[model samples]
Target chain A: MLARLARARTGGLAALVAVVALLPLALTNNYHYEVAIVVGLNAIVCVGLNLLIGYAGQISLGHAGFYGLGAYGSAILTVRYGWPPAAALVASTAGAAALAYLVGRPILKLRGHYLAMATLGMGIIISIVIATEDRVTGGPDGMAVAPFAVLGFTLAGERVWYWVIGAALALAVWLSLNLIDSPAGRALRALHGSEVAAQVAGVDPARYKVLAFVISAVFAAVAGSLTAYYAGFITPAKASFLHSIELVTMVVLGGLASTFGAVIGAAVLTTLPQVLTLLKDYEMMVFGAVLMLCMIYLPRGLVPTIADALARRRR
Target chain B: MSTFTLKHFTRAALAASLAFGAAAAMAQAPIKIGAFLSVTGPAAFLGDPEQKTLELYVERINAAGGVLGRKLQLVSYDSGGDAEKARTFAKRLIEQDAVDAIVGGSTTGETMAVVPLVEQAGVPFVSLAGAVVIIEPVKKWVFKTPHTDRMACEKIFVDMQARKISKIALISGSGGFDKSMRGQCLKVAPNYKIEVLADETYGGGDTDMTAQLTKIKNTAGVQAVLNAGFGQGPAIVTKNFRQIGLTVPLYQSHGVASKEFIKLAGPAAEGVRLPAAALLVAETLPDADPQKKVVVGYKRAYEERFKQDVSTFGGHAYDGLMLVVEAMKRAGTTDKAKVRDALEGIKGFMGTAGVVNMSPADHMGLDLTAFRMLEVKNGDWALVK
Candidate 1:
């Protein structure tokens, strides 16, 4: 059973890499690459979010706040203070992690809806600050971000960004899978199943919950920094409550506790709007209907439901 | 006999070649105009009409023997008021659609997000958003249709000077437009010899401005008050100004130039003044005014076609599309650089806003004369003169 689980993990990672590598074959233009890059960035954020919401059963409605902080942090550091892009990215990600650590310890004590509301408030506050502090963040008008550079080499264009995001996504998935397979991951799952029982079984719920929150925030922050750099502009909209909700929805729709499910969910939700442009004025209506039908038909989420069906068929 | 048959075959081949050449000439590729607008989100009020205007004019232009004898193709996307999505759509427009020019950015946020992309792509982008940042310092490839908040400040201050009202109170909202306009007004007040006696601001979602208004009312030597904001905030301010019975002339920024403002503020809006495009008071314009014919024609056509009230937002789109078309006509080719040059060299072109006179220094290409001073009378907009 151990060998089979190990093999499955390797197989999933190999398949994900293969898909990322092969996706360019289908992308005939830069637009397709741009969309794919966005999908990968969202996948990276969702994978980390899945660790908290899916594995530890902690709900956060303000994860976008962390993401926004990372974006604005990097943008401000590079554009205003003239810091190196790579250092700015690392600094921003670390800052986001530190903030998540401090806030998560106190807020993660609350479960379910209270936690959700707290996170939601946190995101709204961040968004408002970004909008109000126009002198620095350019307020709601947004500010231009300096191009991403490392060692005097600039990373420009959609094709180059596609590969960067693709690699980051693969790394994110690998790390998430490894964490889930480890003892800490078991403690998280145990706590999620029953916090009282997990505590009785010698699992420190508070420590693991904060650990998950900080890790997820790091993921969101890193993705956000890359997004700001990639787009060469940053806006408060990145940290809006709506964006946080979208990230959580991607996790739920992809399936809880499944790393690849999160990735698939990100891709679908990101690309759905672009594809739905054909519907013109009816695009929103159709998009809402499609999401509703998906939820109704696949209540366990897309990946989990499909995986379950495949297992039952083998039996 | 063999020579005669060969001559007939050669003649048929020549005829076929001539027909093919004629077909190729007739099917000249269209000039593609791309756009990304916030058509279905918070800024939908600005973008929806803009989209309608583009579609309406693109069709009309094609029917009227199109620019340079080639049909105009408008490829637009709904960005849903998300700046990130707007950037993505602008990328698709530049990289995939390969449009000759871009002509939409419905809000300042969306417009500013797209500025870098269009500049890098070296595409002429005429933004419909109202912000000084879009045109200030004059980005090589960027232009805008709407008057900036700074220009609105200047126009309002000029009107105040004409009325000999130097001492004024300023009340603004915390929203981006409100803040930017307030900042601009403060910066330029000295140039017009105006003194700001009182300054107050309310939150974006604030419904009551009675306290702010009362403070302004009690300020000594306050000749007029300028409220710099849009949406329901300005209307609420107007009503509160009346409720408090402040008799000073209430000046509003161009933000509330729409008829909806009057409807919302009710009778209190009757004496309120604002600087707006001539489009709002099209019917009241003198026949000799340069923009009168153009604004009236556009207003009538838009209203007749869409069955909706003509908005300055839609007029922005009309100006954007027409400017690009006019540039293409003058350039005599769809070449990007040449068309951009033609756009900058445009002078005395009558648009919905007014006579546009673009130059290397000014990408927006409109002056104080472009904004017409108007006041609400009998619950409708009237020319201030």
Candidate 2:
């Protein structure tokens, strides 16, 4: 039974890679491709966030600030300082990772709602700074981003970015899967199941918690930088407190600890509103209704709950 | 026989080339004007009317043979008054909707978020949002039809100085636009020789302005109060002043210039004054003003079509869409480059709101001189001396 489950997970991951690789052909339109690209970006962040929330059992309500930092880092470096986009992407992730590490050491000590509030405050402060510093981030108006360039070739159009992001996402998933199989991954899983038990079992609970926080922040930041280049515009809204909530919701709605679920969740939430535009006058109300229904009915999320039901029926 | 065949072939080729050129010109689509406003949130009061302006103007242009013989197609989106949502919708409009120009700004935050999108798309945008920074960064593509918060501050302070009101108080909401305006008001207060007696703030949607109002009303030598917000700002003028029994004259920011303010403020809005562009006076405009015909025509048309009274927000949209159409008409093509040049080079262009004369140096083309002092009389904005 365990071997079959492992095989099924691996098969799912492979199928995901194949679909992402061929997303452009399936979408067949620039608008559709753009939505798919956004889904990929969100998935990258969700996968990293999943490590902290799903596996390590931590919550971060301020992940969007790291994402914003990544976007602004790339934008300011390329547009203002004239640095290459690739270098800016690295700088942004490093910056977010370092900051998250510094802040998480203190804040991660608190559990549940206390940790959530601390992270939320960090995000609000970052958003306010970005918004008020109009001279640097162009104030609230935002700034243009230089297009993505890799090894002396300009990356333009939807299809090219689709392949690039797809490959990156696959690598990230593969790395995460390997991490889950490794010893440290087991420590994170142990902590998720029970922090007190993990500590009794010789895991340094605080150290692992902070490590996961920094890793998740880095992922969000890198995703943001890539998004900035793709959209050719970066705004402080990327770091807004609500954006962080949206990112977290994608992970929660997808089912925690499930890589495939994260990807599915991002794609659905990002594209759902575009399709829901037909609601017009009742768009937000309808959106709220859908969210309520999803929470009430699919509490364990789309993947795990459905799989568990199917297994039970078979038994 | 060979000579005759050559001549005929040459003539046929020339005719075909001319036909191709004509077809290409005809195939050029009508210039698309996208109207984005907060249709479903706090700024909905403003955006609802802004939509009407877009609708009525497009209908009028189509009725009058249209711009350059092509009807204007107005595409509207709801920004929801959220800055992030505004950014996303701006991208969708430019990239997916393929709009020729974009107009929005029911709030300072949303307008500012859209500036980069306009710059990246190189699409001309005129925001109704009143942040001065929306235009000051010299983004080539972004302009504003609404007066800036800085402009609003200057207008009020200048009026205060002219009236010899030395001590005043500033009460603002904590929302992004409110805070921005409050800062601008304080920044320029010193310049106008008016001392800020007190400065107070409350959170957005907080109905009890009593704390801020009490603080302001009790300040010694306070002769004026600049209410620095929209929507609830007028409610302060109505409720707080009478509750606290403070009878000093209240000067509202142009953000409060709307019939809805009068409706909400009830009898207290009777003599409250503010500085605004001409759309605020469209309903009560005198026949003698040269632009009265266009102004009144729009007011009636907008009301009939959208089933709502127009606000300055709608007026800005009206001017924004017209400005884009005027440029398109002058360029005789929807080619973005030519349209941009025509927009920047706009001269003596009469809009319902103001006479816009753009140059390479100034995108708005209208300044403090464009505003007139308007007073609320008989539940309508009357042009006051």
Candidate 3:
């Protein structure tokens, strides 16, 4: 069983890479490349978010706060102190992980909306601090971030960014899949199914929950760092409550406990607006209708519903 | 027989060539003007008018045999007052649509978000938002039409100086615009020799600012009070200021330069002062004034078409698009570089806002003279005389 699971995980990683590689071929212009890069960044964040929310039964309404911290941390370090971009990225991700560990330990003890409200407040407080601290964060106007570079090679243009973000997203999926197939992953899933049962079965719920929270926050932080470099600017809007809700919606809209579904969710939500924008004034209306229809017909989300149908047909 | 066939073939070839030339001239593409405004969010009041003004002017310009004899094509998107959306649309406008120039941005934050993209893309961006940072430490491609926060501060201080109100209080909303305005007021207060006795701030949605007002009311030697922000926040401050019975003359930033503010604040809006563009009081301007004709004409056309009172926010869009069109006319081509150069070279171009004179050193050529101090009287704007 372990060997087969390993083989399937490898297959999933390979499939993810193949899809990402083919995505740019469909893009004919610079704008498409730009949007595709955004999709990859959002997917990286959502994949990690799905790990906690889907597999561990944890809800984070303030994931954008971690994302913002990661972005602003890298930005302030590199722009102010002139730290190397790569070093800043690592340091910021570690910082976010540490923060999540501290906050998640206590917050994870709560269940349902109580957990949701705490996370929501956490995100708002981060946003307000970033906005109000004009001296460092450049206030609401936001400060510019240095272009991403490694060992004296500057990363430029949407085409280059697409590959970078794509690779990062693939890494995120691989990591999440591996984590899900491990002992800790099983522990999280057990807790999700029945906390009392899992606790009785010798699974330390608190330790695994905090570990999952740290991992998810690190994912968000990394994605945020990449976005800051790619967009050439950063703002407190990244940490706003609306952004946090959007991230949660992406995870829920995609099938729970599925690694690939998170990617699909991010890709669809990002690209849908760009495509529907051609509809002009009816853009939001159509977007809302599409979301409503998807939920109504495919309540289990796109991936799970389709997978369930395929399994039944095979039977 | 060979000579006759050769002659017929020559005639057919000439006719085909003429048809091709005619088709090519007829296909002279319209110059694309891209805009992204906050048309559907918290800042919708600003973007709605700005978008309408762009639409209204584009139709008018095309009707009058468009600039450089090519019809203007306005491609606009609603940013919804979000920076990420603004960046995406800014990129789309520049890269995908390949618009020759852009003339939109509703809030200071949205404009700032797109500044780097526009600068990097080398697209001439004429912002409709008011912020000193947009133009200062000047960017090569970005320009703005509205007066800066610094200029507004100077205008208010100059008015306060004339009234012999040596000591004043400052309370601002915590938004980006309010912060910058507050910063400018504090920065320039010492230069004007006016003392600020108290400084306080409230959130964008805070219902009551009485606590902040009460502090200012108790502060000694406080002769005037200035509230810096846009939307209902400023109105709430006004209501709270009056309710707390602070008799000091209340001042507001140009952010609330619309009648909606008066309606929101109701009777409390009475006697408040702020600096604004002459367009707000075009009908009252003397005939000898250069801005009178232009301002009045825009007011009539906009009100007749939209059935709403003209606003300075819309006037900013009007100025932005017209400036780009004028630059295009001067350049005589749709080339981005030439349009940008021509935009910088624009001198003394009279518009509804003010007599705009663009220079390399000064993107927003209007100084403190561009702002007119007005006091609210009987629920209406009256020029401060």
Candidate 4:
């Protein structure tokens, strides 16, 4: 562990993860903790998304549909249907996976801009359906989520969820790190590089691509389930196209293909609004400006660029 | 340096000076209310008037000594009707600028997005948005001055029964408020002897509502079509009716009371009846209704300030802020619980929305008395009854 910590890249990531895990300790207010927990949730979603967008060289401008479905599915099942939170989570994940599998087969076949539109339409349709089915989903009014309960222990308070989301984020990060270094991960990277080249290399691009989509979707589903349980309220906006854009922004801004970047991106984007609250009416303008600046200044995203800097200094 | 270089330098200096001037104006000390609106998006037409209303009301309040005896300041953020942006701006209002209260995001969707942020911080939130779910389940920290969709639907159906219009076609957006409106319409329709012939649905940003309207048009014995949503309400009133050649009387959801709806639907809006909170038709109201003196003044002030007509969207926002101020005065401090108590316990308070009579059980104090039947006469909302 000490040896791993001695390496610049690995050490930095470990320390960063520890800081994030310990964030609630420094945060006194529920609002701050809420923001921190949400950022962690977003980081979890972004991690899987990074693998798909960064490692697989694909675009999704509609992952929020999956996230929304997962959130509403978990909330409705657990709260309304009297299912266990864990069972609801499983249902949510399974449902999202099945939906992704069905949608991805046709949508993924459409390639490029067409795929983007197809995915976007799916997201829009989901949003519309959730909004319309008021008796079941609570429509635009948003549905209340069931609290996370395990073995008859109900999870309440910011402190509880701070830990819960923090732990989940940690496990998600570890899984991504391990997966990115695996043989399948290498094949994904090959596919990311060039579809034709990857096929020639016997990479089975279609299989890997579909697998990546499913995995990314599962990650989003888990995050959505966690969000519903934690926030205790879920709306159709969870699946909005703008939300999908935000998820992608978190991945790209964090450093796509970099495990630590996802977390970093989520943390920065989430907290930036909090800090820029002084802008009041001009907050959106400032947010837009910051995004533009980030795109222009750090094209590779924050984590990777920071890693590069630290590595350069060490050399 | 050449003449060209001097000209470039002069232009840059002018730009810098203008920037400095703007910065100076923005930094002025005042008791600020940070508002999140749905301007420049799908809800922009409704939101722009609200933006105008906030500015006008803030100006009115300031001219009238402002809230808490300090000049009430307003710094508005546009959410573009997006939930994430609404959440972001809500945080910005509370954590960053420390706004006394927040107002004006155009939909239930936008208001719901801001609920957690305000509730967590214990800030008094007054939404202009018409979603009952925003205040229902009683967060104790949030409130709205507008008549909810369910209440409006209930009111409309009651009127429909009075008019003996039993057979109705219902079309609604697949949103929370729309669903609520439709459900309430269906539930109370039977009570009022109104039968819903067809239940049609549409989603956000769908420009065409013809297919659903056509289905309703073909239905036998459909006396009136009740559109229980926004965005596409007036378009449905105009294009679909003319396209299907159905002249059955059309009733609308309160969401259609926006000025843009009148513009969007053209002359087809003339005979359409909708339950509106009194603020929309204030201008054409008879001089001595006497009860609407404040509303009339507000309409006049809003028009004078914005150089545009006032709509129900901003009217509710104006009423919400006024209610907050009244509560603050009654409570004598910005105590969240006191403000909440004062608001919940309010009685006989005349506002642009209506005579607001808040109670513990009823968060929204307005009712059918808050609205009279309003029609579009000469491209503006006029009191029909």
The lDDT leader among the candidates is 1
> Interface RMSD values for the candidates, listed in order?
1.2, 4.1, 1.6, 3.6
Candidate lDDT (C-alpha), each: 0.90, 0.77, 0.88, 0.77
Residue B335 in candidate 2, Cα distance off native in Å: 3.7
Q: Provide a comma-separated list of chain B TM-scores, one per candidate.
A: 0.91, 0.82, 0.88, 0.79
Which candidate do you rate higher for TM-score, 3 or 4? 3
What does candidate 2's lDDT look like per residue over A56-96, in tens digits?
Answer: 78888999999999998889888889898888899888999
Candidate 1 residues lying further than 4 Å off, grouped into runs, are A1-7, B1-27
lDDT of each residue in B1-385, candidate 3, tens digit only: 9999999999997876677436465357678999999999778989999999999999999999998878999999998888888988998999888899999989888898899888888999999888788898889999999888888999999999999988998999877888888998899999999998899989888998888998888898899999889778999999988898988899998889888899999999999999989998899887998888888988899999999999888989999998999998899877789999999999988887788989999998787778999999999999998
Q: Once model 1 is optimally superposed onto the true structure by TM-score, how far is the C-alpha of residue B200 displaced, in angstroms?
A: 1.1
Q: Sort the candidates on DockQ, descending order.
A: 1, 3, 4, 2
Q: Write the per-residue lDDT of candidate 1 for residues A1-315, one digit (tens) a residue.
A: 212222388888888898999999999987888899999999999999999999989888999999999999999999999999999999999999998888788877765556677778888998999999999999888999989989889999989999999999999999999999899999999998999999899988889999998999999999999999998877888899889989999999988888888998999999999999988889999989988998999986778888877766767
Chain A only: list TM-scores of all candidates.
Answer: 0.96, 0.94, 0.95, 0.93
- Report clash pairs, candidate 1: A134-A139
Evaluate candidate 3 by giving its C-alpha RMSD to the native, one decimal: 5.0
- Candidate 2 docking band: incorrect
In candidate 2, residue B287 scores what lDDT?
74
lDDT by residue (B1-385, candidate 2, tens digit) is 9999999999997876578447555554565787678887656877887876777778878899877767678777787776655766777778877887887767776776667667767888887876666667566887677767787788777777788898988778755567678878888888888898898877666877887788787788899887888667557646777778878878787777666688898877877778887766765666787667766777777777778666666777888888888788788877777888888989877666677778777777776656777777887777776
The regions of model 4 sitting more than 4 angstroms off are A1-10, A101-118, A194-202, B1-63, B66-106, B110-124, B134-141, B157-178, B197-225, B236-248, B262-264, B376-381
Tell me, by DockQ, which candidate is best: 1
For candidate 2, give the lDDT of residue A267: 77
- How far off is residue A183 in model 4, in Å? 2.1
lDDT value for model 4: 0.77
What lDDT tens digits, residue by residue, belong to model 4 across residues B1-385? 6999999999997876577436344334456677888876777876788887777777877898876666777878777776656765677678766776676667777787677767778887888777666767777777787787677877787777778788888888765556677777787777777778799888767778788888887899898888887666556546677767879888887767777787788877777788876676676678877557888888788777778777767777778778878887888755567877888888998888788888877777776778777777777777766
| Candidate 1 structure quality by residue, lDDT tens digits, B246-356 | 999999989888878998999999889999989988998999987889999999999999898999999999999999998988998878999999999998888998789
Q: Would you estimate the TM-scores of all the predictions?
A: 0.93, 0.77, 0.92, 0.84
